[model samples]
Target: MHMLSRPSVLRFDWRPTIRTLPEGQFVAAIGDVHGHDHLLAAMHDAIRRELDELGPRSAAVIHLGDLIDRGPRNREALVRARAGIDGASAITLRGNHEDRLLAYLGGSPAALGPWLDAGGEGMFTQMGLDPWRISPGEFRARFGEDLARWLEATPVMHRIGQLVFVHAGIDPALPLDRQDPHTLMWTRRAWIDSPGPYPEGVAVIHGHIPRRTVDFRDRHRIDLDSGVVNWGILSGLVFHGDRMRLLQVS
Candidate 1:
């Protein structure tokens, strides 16, 4: 997943198909929070204000994952996120970090080493779930049950009208229903650099690879991840009918 230091230049014009939902429907897709709970709350407040201003309408708030890791108060952030979406019409997708955490909790040898190396240990330590002090089975029984159930139930991709929300971009080569979860959560270089969008003129709204600003690289692909854990802004793209708006919190 090597992001181009300099994106390649292309000669042809790409007129992407513009998509829209019903007149009174709205959708908001948020980027990776990565344990930054304050930013998450701020973004939510902003969204609430926007929705209120738009008048009464059926709407959904979608969270692109990576909810924990590499920042302070991982457990608290998770709790906040869960509470935020608990009784609301919202969606939370599973990120690569969530997948790896599940693998570690299940004691998969292939995932344990890499998960620890990727800051899982620090997150567990901050949450007072010391992996060295408890067996994986005990940990699973004690701490992982509820969270794992929630994560396992989360969908890898969601479609609202013509827009698709996912943790990461899909491989355009595969049918939407047949997209692999692994690739949906972890793919980078190939998916991002691919030539076009999904079939049937559906646009992909995702977050995984971070950028300093919102990426409209391909007209049909919208990247909301601005890398909040790295001191970048946490952002959300609000879709209302045929228009889109950007909401952010630093």
Candidate 2:
């Protein structure tokens, strides 16, 4: 796969659909978008074609977050999501970027640089606002409702039969509902080192570390963050019962 620089975007072979679910297969966890609307569209098209081929009444789509930033159409992406296609099977999670925006809105200084450096500035710039000068109150007053609603529904972890879908990784030590947002949005090592029988029989399926491997340690948990903003395509896992398959976006 190739990721173009300048305005980074991923390029890779894309799959139109899944033919089999292997009995218990249900959810598809999508990686970060970082505002790459074109790639998102291609991904959506591929997903839809596949679903159309496979039937939407059977499987669900679980987007692992980082849905906005980097690319040019953050707002439009949200709008499309609001429209909800492929039979309303869309589920978007809150990535660290969204978390930072929430923190920025809630009045936090730590979020500024990271946000700006990671393309949050572009989104604000697109909206005709200077990322540096915006205040929390002002931010909330401006993007509050929509963002709040987006965050409110973003799931920390998705449990489908035995698979656990999360944006980042869970503390594994902390019980599911008890896990911290920080862990859910960033912790990597803890998730990798997580011993067995973690807080229910849930096999942790997650994203965050954008890599080529799709980085799976245990057969149960998988990471699909293929670094779309870095020019890597948004990747996903197609599960057939306990077996998992990879689908890349070009």
- Winning candidate number (lDDT): 1
TM-score of each candidate structure, all chains considered together: 0.86, 0.78
Model 1: per-residue Cα lDDT over 1-250, one tens digit each = 4332321211122222246778888777889988777778777777777677775368888888888777665666666666664223778888888888788677665676677776677576775777767766776676558876776687888998788888988989888888999999999999868757577778888899888887555678888888886755788877777677777777
Report the Cα lDDT for candidate 2: 0.67
Model 2, runs deviating above 4 Å: 1-25, 107-114, 140-144, 195-197, 240-244
Model 2 C-alpha RMSD to native? 5.0
lDDT of 2 by residue, 1-250 (tens): 4554432323334332222244644456678877776666666666665556545345777778777787777766655554445553677777787776666765777777777776777678667887667775676666657756666567666666666677888886778879887888888776767655677756676778777566554544667787776755777665544444566775
Itemize residue pairs with steric clashes in candidate 2.
3-231, 9-231, 10-231, 12-250, 17-50, 34-69, 210-225
lDDT (CA) for every model shown? 0.75, 0.67
